[model samples]
Target: MTTRNIVHLDADRVYWTTEVTYDRFPARQLWALAAPIHELVIPARLRHAAGASRPGDLQHQLVTTFQRRLGNPVLSRLPGQTLLETTGRSSGLPRQTPIGGRRVGQEFWLVSEFGERSQYVRNIQADPRVRLRLHGRWLRGVAHLLPDDDARARLKSLPRLNSTAVQAFGTDLLTIRIDLD
Candidate 1:
């Protein structure tokens, strides 16, 4: 039997651990490990080998919800380690300008790439109050990062940005935690 470890982490540095046996590991395991790390809750139904498909995956949905929203949510770390701000395009449209809002939970995850140093990062360092729009949905939320040492350490380990954009712009890629208010 395959045993999977389930760890739960709360805002106060509290963590719970449990083990689950399964004939075969499911893809959900990847997100399961990260859910707690990111303060997200995974439904029990998804824990099983055959996880149910999310609602937005179906076509003809009029309005997109947080779960359906797409794109790389923009993030910024506040000064004094107080908070981390996330922002992105709300409508998931390429030309549609981003609007101010909180990033829908589970909509996006941190990528290996370090975004180019631009207004987004500069504004984050200057002020903790930041906004983000989703790539293909109309939703947002303003959040402050919870104080967690482990989370901060994880963010620090991300590979530095060395893309052509960074070289051309002469910008440095910085890593910071995501704090929701």
Candidate 2:
């Protein structure tokens, strides 16, 4: 039950080493078990505070920073992961984001955790035309924001891991339907 503290270049990357009662203990495996518990047990008051359209507080910054700096890079490289490429509203540059969604026939569907406040969602508003990467291929598509769609119900129909994340961290849920070419 000894704890070891690891400090990286940044505070966000800090890792604490801890011994668990599980057999064949490994740091990665321990983390794999602890991460979900940590997220799920977040206080309701904190979740509510962090789940605003644009939260300027520390919690929101911490979550977004870790995801952008670490999570996105890892998820984007995974096989069969869906990616959404949107045109930046002001910069007019291609902004590629790794997303979770399902492809059914000629349409792809997903929900945004941050609703219109998400960067990708805002980009889609600027220009409905977008591109999607799925099954190792890039394809053109048009994005449609479905405000009327029930986000919680939509999560039930999406991949479990992503749906769980959306439910845990999302402040405002937004549904997006992409018509593929």
TM-score of each: 0.23, 0.68
Error of 2 at 106 (Å): 1.0
lDDT of 2 at 32: 74
What stretches of model 1 exceed 4 Å from their correct place? 1-117, 138-171
Off by over 4 Å in 2: 1-59
Cα lDDT of model 1 by residue, 1-181, tens digit: 3445575656644344445454556645764664443332333223322354443222112111221243222221222111223333343222221222222354222211122223344444444344333443333333232223233233333323422322223222333333333
For residues 1-181, what per-residue lDDT tens digits would candidate 2 score against the true structure?
2344443445433333334444455865876766654543433334454463335333454556577878889988887878899999999999989999888899999999888878899999999999999989999999999999999999999999999988888877899999998
Please list all clashing residue pairs in model 2, or write none if there are none: none
| CA lDDT, every model vs. true structure | 0.32, 0.79
Q: Please give the range of 10 consecutive residues that has the lowest summed lDDT in model 1.
A: 58-67
- For model 2, what is the C-alpha lDDT against the true structure? 0.79
